[model samples]
Target: TEHEVQRWPLEPQGSTSFGLSRDGRFALLYSEEHHLVLWDLEQNKKLATLGELDADGNAVSHIRISDNGRFAVTAGQMNFAVWDLGWTQAQGLWSISDALIRDIDITSNGEQVLLGLSNGKAIYVNLVTGRRLEFLAHREKVNSVAISPNGRFALTGGNDYKAYLWDTESGQLLRTF
Candidate 1:
């Protein structure tokens, strides 16, 4: 299994995290200082670097890209932000109330964003309208989350040692393990 693709010399210092668009055309890398960088994979060039004013002042825990590549989302320092890549001036931005976002997943259509929080909470937001669909509480922080390719279901794992499957459209708890 050799996917050995071209390697770009990323940042030399600072703990960082990465995210790839669903279609694999775009990517994002963040430094420990909450520095955000957008990369164009197809062009193999750096597309944008979100400056200090654009990124949160502190470090981020995780990041995710929408399926349609219209938006980029990140969680950090008690904040969850949404970025509109297509817009030129400070794209769309928003914050979550509880701010425990640890891991995130986007729907294939890019209309919905799901977040797993550090406080054992799960949040599902409708990106298109910036509305919250569900706020699920857990006993421990959520560690990871994934949405089915078909957009039919979502699975979330938490430090509470549990995983849950939910209906994407209806926001119903489908199963738990």
Candidate 2:
């Protein structure tokens, strides 16, 4: 048998949440201190910070890593930030809508993002083109958003006791449950 492990400090682990890269080489750590730290598990240490601090230094409420481990999205107070994990280390920050972001998820190809908002809006953002499409998704705050495994659709649930299915490319409502 074989074993794999890394040293993640237990001290000050304030309200921590994490995302592991698909290849299992790295981990992204977010804490209540308003910081996101990337760790190189193979080498057993921190790699770099995922993104710059927000204006108000708000703690990250939600985050998702792409299927290839090449991209990540962090939900900010008034917007969301996408991080390019490629060597070039580029990033895109978008304030596509004014609704308060409640949660977010990146697609398998890392091309788009679906965000659930407190304003009852489900926003789809094109990461490469920076295009946005937002529509009223619920009567109250949306609790979650998920991309289908085949990448053809999205599912979003809210406080209104409903879950919606949306076309990934067109952002059109496909079903209600």
Tens digits of lDDT, candidate 1, 146-170: 8664556788898778899888677
Candidate 2 per-residue lDDT, tens place, 1-177, comes to 776654456226564457777788877767765377777788777777655536566666677888778777777667677777665253766774567888888877667888888888888777668677875868999889987544568899999999999886776889999
RMSD of 1: 3.4
| lDDT computed for candidate 2 | 0.74
Worst lDDT run of 10 residues, candidate 1, spans 87-96
What candidate 1 gets wrong by more than 4 Å, as runs, is 1-6, 32-34, 52-56, 88-90, 128-130, 135-137, 148-152
Which residue window of length 10 is worst by lDDT in model 2?
A: 6-15
TM-score of each: 0.77, 0.79
Candidate 2 pairs with clashing backbones: none
Cα deviation at 159, candidate 2, in Å, is 0.7
Task: Report lDDT (CA) for all predictions.
Answer: 0.71, 0.74
Q: Pick the candidate with the highest lDDT.
A: 2
Cα RMSD (angstroms) for every candidate in the order listed: 3.4, 3.8
